[model samples]
Target: MPTILTVPGYQNSGPGHWQSLWEASLGGVKRVEMSSWEHPVKAAWVEALDEAIADCQEPPILVGHSLGCLAIVHWAEGHDREIRGALLAAPSDVERPDALAVLRPFGPIPRLRLAFPAIVAASSDDPFLSPARARILAADWGARFVDLGPCGHLNQASGHGPWPRGEALLSDLR
Candidate 1:
């Protein structure tokens, strides 16, 4: 089985979130621990992510949500580690200043194509990032894009208690 590294967004995924649930249920699933969950520094996050990947015995598949997706992109932009793929869900727009003040620093997201394979799954009703922008991001990264209609943020509040489709997507990457 492929190592599934879950990279959670700002404030971190809570107990009820899909990422957390996957960690509990799946084997070889690990959560990337950021230095600070409530207060995120882009450099810190990127470094932490690198450390997490290094800890893995094999190249691990990255599963990022919201800001975590941006972290994976930034990490990939600088490093060329051999991994399975990335599953980017509800990628939050750090460029947008309206949401949270902490998310502003990770702005000016990298548009470079990822070295490894990746799949971007976005929701139509995600307030963090618009569907159009998500598609563009996927295109820029040269990853397959999936439009999941009206699933807000694809998080705990979005009601994805057990995201089976996301699991299937991860399986494809594996």
Candidate 2:
């Protein structure tokens, strides 16, 4: 079985977050730790993801949220290593003013097709990226898009704790 690499967004996923819950329950889930979660430097994050993938014994399933999704896309821009699939949820719009203040380094979102199978789950009312933009991004990345209605960022406050629906979505990746 392939390992599942959990990549959290800016500031990291808290204990009540779904990613954290999934890690606790899932057998082969490991987080791709960033050097600085508060101040994400694109190069550093991309390098960290690269190293994690390089260390994997087999191609891993990448589960990324928010800025983590951008990091995976950025990592895929350069690395061509084979992977099982990617499950991206609530991807943030780094180019937006609010996000740009922190995620400006990850700008120029890669509009290229992903090298592996991918599924993008997006919230309709997410303050970061509009649902339409999320759909466009999914199309650009050649990923299957799932519209999660009115779920704000799909974080804890969005009432997504232990989101079993998302777990099912991850299972669909294969």
Give all TM-scores, in the order shown: 0.97, 0.97
After superposing candidate 2, which stretches have Cα over 4 Å from the reference? none
TM-score: model 1 vs. ground truth: 0.97
lDDT of 1: 0.92
For candidate 1, write residues 112-145 as lDDT tens digits: 9998899999999899999899999999999999
RMSD of each: 0.9, 0.9
Q: Against the unseen true structure, what C-alpha lDDT does each candidate score?
A: 0.92, 0.92
- lDDT of candidate 2? 0.92
Clashes of 1: 0
Worst 10 residues of 1 by lDDT: 93-102
